[model samples]
Target: MPAPELAAVPGSQDPAPAETGTSRPTATSTGAPGGDAPLGFTGAGTGEVSSGSPDAAAVEEPAAPAEEAPPSTQDSPVGSEPAEGAPATREEVPTAAPTAPAATPAEPTATPAEPAGSAATTSEAAAPAESTAPADSAAPTDRAEPTDGAPSSEAAAPGEAAAPGEAAAASEAAAPTDGAAPTESPTPTPGPRPAPSPSPRPRPTPRRQVPTPAAVAPAAAAPSVVAPVDAHDAAEAAAWGRVDDDGTVYVREATGERVVGQYTGADTEEALGFYVRRFLDIQAQLALFEARLAQITPKEIDQTLATLTEALAEPAVVGNVDGLRERLEKLRSAAGERRKQAAAEREAARAQAVAERTVIVEKAEQIAEQDPARTQWKQSGQRLRDLLDEWKTAQRTGPRLDRPTEDKLWKRFSHARTAFDRHRRQYFSELDATQDQVKAAKEKLIARAESLSTSTEWGRTAATYRELMDEWKAAGRASRKDDDALWARFRAAQQKFFDARSAQNAEIDAEYGENLKAKLALLEQAEAILPVTDIKAAKAALRPIQDKWDEAGKVPRADVQRVEGRMRAVEQAVRDAEQAAWKRSNPETKARAEGAAAQLESAIAQLEEDLAKARNGGDAKQIADAEAALEARRTWLDQVQRAVHE
Candidate 1:
């Protein structure tokens, strides 16, 4: 028999449940039935882990120390006894911690005080000894320090004292060996007195023990503080972890069950319930992570995934471990999807940025290519600058386009802006030069006009003013505003001179009206000579009329050109007739005319001969040329004859 921590009741058999040493969080023992009681978790350290995945949860490194331990969590009914046909076994429940000082070995008694270190059960049936040791869970063992130098088996021989360092098989029953005569086993030595309340007689268990009842409540003063899990977590706890009769705790995994340390608490159910609550907490964390999946980056997800992966690998918890892993896998898949979605979004943004840059470049080019003569320089230039600003803004805020694409757009935009600036400067420079020339020319004209404004030599001055007005019309315009002002000054100066001339003419105009009427009558008489057949008569008649026109003279200023022009027409007709008459009277002139007519007649005769030769030779172009030359010569001969006759 081993001195286990779970101490037993005085006499009734059916082995007592175990006591375990676990690094659980601080808790207040509920001391409920089963073995270890439900604990009120303090949440100060490890026991603060919820009933579920304890190892997987983020918790403080410090493990909670045990608060209290009652000898028996199970309350024995009054007058209860061992089953009549059942084996009379003594379950050695562990009563003290492994760190407790070696118990003072006590004298033998009918019902021994169970040792304080390890747990053991001695089956003393009437049949030969048969010991049952369950398949051990990987859960850690709590053993006592050895008193003897030699090692011993789990079931000691009759009269042997409880050996130290021997772990009692958990959740298993024991009986005498088959065919061996029944032997009465020595009673175990009384060990350290365990302060315990009375407990019910434990039922005999088979090799594979059935599940135990819920842990009974501990004394109210039980020292450990345990955080309470929602009662709903118990089902989840059962799904992942279980406690053997000897108090070995295990967590179920996909690969099979593995140890998660012993549950030194009240009972199997309470132990599993504690870890189940922890699993729920971790599950909560998963839910939160899922909620934040959109906001967090893929890298953040990877880190969290790695952390959760490590947590789930060897967690101290009870729940669906495989389910948690599945959740982790789902999270990973979601992260991948998020990465793809984000990439797509970035690509779309980049494309939009590229399009925007292209628009800026195109607009700048349009401004640059406008005709400098017609361009609205101020507005167009400002628009280019605005486009540049837009480009900068897009660069700063929009997703990055490929370097090559961005650079290409920038070059185009910059080139266009530069070209536009150069064009604007050049256009303004030329306009300035042109405007300077116009101002200079106009200034000279204005100076000349101002000097001429006071001239009173009416006839000569009027002729000079006509010349000045003609020069002004020949000069091109200046800028509208400057030209308009300059023109007004020039008109005022001219008008002043014209007004003086007009006033003087007003008095003379009546006298000039008579002169104008006389000139007009003389013009009619002279113009009648235009159709004259007799050269001598036309010349003699026009000479008299022109003489009379000269004497009449001085028409109104407005009528002067009109009168003079009509007189000139008549004089020109007379002069033309006289020149012809004079030429006809010259001996040399008649001789030349006769000679030219005779030559043309002779040429026409030669052309007729050439035409006949061309026709004979079938040369179509030569024949046509000969015929044209003959016709021209004949026409010239007729004109010479007519002139000589006239």
Candidate 2:
């Protein structure tokens, strides 16, 4: 049906020859109805249809008159050539008629046939064009189906094209419409229109090129359309990416229509595990550093920091950079506090140590100035040791201190202790030597005194022994053991000498007893002569007794006084008798002699002359004879004096 209608339009004549740009005769050109008849047909091509000959034109002319004039009522479809005479025919047709379905013969080619019933009313007014043609021909068949019941559907096609030409067209038509039914078949084929299905055939249409900046502008300008990524997840992925074998994810600019980025979660579990382990490792390292910090003195801070830095650089730990950064902040805060405290502690410890050391040093100087042998270095050492013990114990239990300062103080304390010990030892050693000297001197004295104890030279030797005892008393004390023994020995020697002298004194007393008895008898004879009457006779008699008394050996001290008193009485009697006789023999001379002898006669006349003569002659018998003669002379002289005086 489509082939003959295409043949009926003069513009569709000789379709093959028109495609080839060659002229042919119209009568035999079966693709179109007339060749050069100029029937005002507006369709795809006029030049091709015009190439047919006159015979072909005569046979197809009547059919052309039927369809050509009707189709000429509508304007040309887009990209179709203008009919040579159709613009004038298009003007002759009333505007309302061209809009009517019957006015458009080419409606079947432009619209689908699904609603063919509506075309009957519109085509009735224009029924002559189809009636003049044969009922069974392809042209009438083509027109009858699309126009009979679906005339409104046919008019809808040309109405769409005319609507755009209207200046006052509805504003609703300007807006984009997604579900509007096809106003007319896409201006090419007229058969059953395929449903406007979404094509799966990949369009080879080249995409319109856009600049990178322009492509990115839409996303940048409309940030709300794009969701934000999780920061924590990003950080975790980044950290894991550092140590994991999988690559990392990061945002980049969009290129053309594609957004740029990476997918670090290629090995999600392993990368996450690596990140977790690195975090734990960082924590462990931080803990170790903290523990070490507790032990560190102020001086060791640099070394500790260096060690921590070295540990942090390990590949195992590098993955935990964020954790490291967090820990570093904490460590820095703690370190600052620790440093402040450590500095304060160090200052306190230094001050205390300096004061204590000053005291110790002063004590040491004092000890050094004193005599090592006599000084109380042991007591000083004990005090210093106690102080040192206190310091050491404080270091163990007290607040933290500087390590270097602690070491220096300990060294000084140890040195001081050594000095104290050295001095103490030297003192005791010298004291031992002094004691030995004293012991030796005492031992020598003891030996000398022990040897002298046996000497017995009475007076001279005893005097020498007394002198030795005095020397011993004056001597210094010996060592305790020797002093006691040596003193005992010296005392024993002196006691021995004194005991012998006492014995000799007793013997000398016994011999003096005999001498005392003989002297007593001689004294009795002298006392008998004291009462004699003659003085001259007594004088002569007492002279011999005095000599006897002198010649007698020493008497006992107890008897000597009594013996001398008796002799004095006897001598006085003899002198008195002699004085009486001389008075008788020479009266004038006797009176002068008596006066001169008054004070002397009593004591002088008591001496017994004979006994005294016997003592003087050293003859015991002679002393006895003199005593008898003196007694007789005293008797005779007393008689003569008495006779003369009468």
Candidate 3:
């Protein structure tokens, strides 16, 4: 049974060859079709045009026929190609027929397929065998099976080239179709379509590692139709590159297509990956740069940006170069902002550092201004050093200070330190001189005290020594070394004086002990003269005793009162005896008694003679006068006699 056939619609000229110079894009194969390989081009565009301008190719060209006619409807399977010699009606033609390549019969030799992807593409290229004829064959039905179902445009008539847009339109039209059942051609045997060059399975584009800017979202990964890749991503990757089976890698840019590098002995996918990795490296560097925007210095960022810019300008890899350039531009703009921010922060930090350093300097000056005499030397010195240390720390770790300001602060601090040092030295020197003078004065006082210590003039010498001690107290202190020695010498002299005075007192008391005994014995002997009967004898004994008592040496002070009291009692007794003797032996009393006795005797004789004469004459008056005189005489005489007898 001959395969089912379609009748030819006659009267149609063989379709004009696809416009000359029109190139068709073939899809780069990633792997065997079963495990998610991208389907080839489904159909052709409505018309033929050059491969250069894609926008013009998208317009509908309903009047244009298939570029290449099918096997004269005799041999073609039903619905395989349009009827021979007759323009195929739109209803009868397969949906993909519009975008099919030229089917002209005049030239049977097939043109070599163009590279897999195009410059300005919105979709994946058609598969290799899907779009291109295997070899020179007259019928569209004789082309490779399992194809994009688009007719060849590379088979266009000579001298009839269309616009560059034909390629893009044809590329879009190269979508695969479900219209015709896959059937082997029965006409001239065509060469078998070249097996799709093996290619490395493309890895899914990884998410960028850089954090998104506060104002921007993360860039999406390049869309691809490769395994484990999206259709959009596949189309995007195709726009940048297409690696050949021969290990050549090509990069397409807005500027133009160029060979970036090669990876010999490597599969198309590996080679492409090798170049793509270089592009990824650029991206990684960009991500790292963005991440470091806040961490690194602005100058460093500028240097790194220069390096990255250079690398991106003529990179060694093949990828979405225009997109990468755009991303770099964004990074450049961000870097400029980051640089400004970093500079501002540094300036602020420097200002703070200057303020801190100024504080340290001022503190040092304050310490230096304190009075040297009252200043705590140890504590003040340590504080100054600590301030200096703080200044050094700020200098080491903080922002650099301007030279003039730093030098001015340092000069003030240094002057303060120098002033303090000079003051300390001068103060200590004067103190040393004063201490020396004090030491000398104390030595003289000690010598004077020592001289007084040995002198026997106890009362006067002790007074002199006391005066010396008072002088020592008035003397100011010396250094500890000299003051202690001076004090020891002075105290020894004072102790010596007191000890000698005590020894002299002890000797005097011993000598006075004998005197006390002698006085006591004399006192007893003198007391025996009390109650004197013979005043002369008592006086004689008392006088010898009194003399002996006087001869006795000074008595002890405790016995002086007792001995003197006994001597006083003996003297009083002798005095009473002397007064009694003087009363008995009075001379005036004897004289008066003798004279009265003589006179009375004479008178009594005279009176008696007179009385006899008168009695004879009988003269009574005369007798009476004589008689009265004789009586008075007798009384005077009797009294005198009594005195002599007593």
TM-score of every candidate: 0.42, 0.29, 0.42
Candidate 3: how large is its RMSD? Answer: 29.4
**Positional deviation of 205 in candidate 3, in angstroms?**
48
Q: With candidate 2 superimposed using the best TM-score fit, by how many Å does residue 75's alpha carbon deviate from the native?
A: 87
Tens digits of per-residue lDDT for model 3, 388-495: 888788888888878997898889888888987888788889999999999989988988887777888888887887788788879989999889998998889888
Best candidate according to lDDT: 1
Candidate 2: tens digits of C-alpha lDDT, residues 1-646: 0021111122111112111212111110102111211111222222112111111110111111112223322223321222222111112322221222342333222221111211221110110100112211111111321234432232333212111111111111221111011111222222232233264221211122111223322221221211122446445534443322322211111111111111121344323332233234345556777777766765676655554454333222113445555666677677878889887877787687666655655665555456675677667767776776776666676655467765666676666667767777787676667667766766676677667666667788687777776776566566677778777777777777677766665576578777677777777766665555556566776788688778777765556677666665675566566666656678676555455445334433554754776698899788777667666656655554455455
Q: Write the per-residue lDDT of candidate 1 for residues 345-423, one digit (tens) a residue.
A: 7889888888888988999999999999999998997898899899889998888888899888989998998999999
For residue 337, give model 3's deviation from the true position in Å. Answer: 3.0
- Cα-based RMSD of the predictions, in order? 20.6, 42.1, 29.4
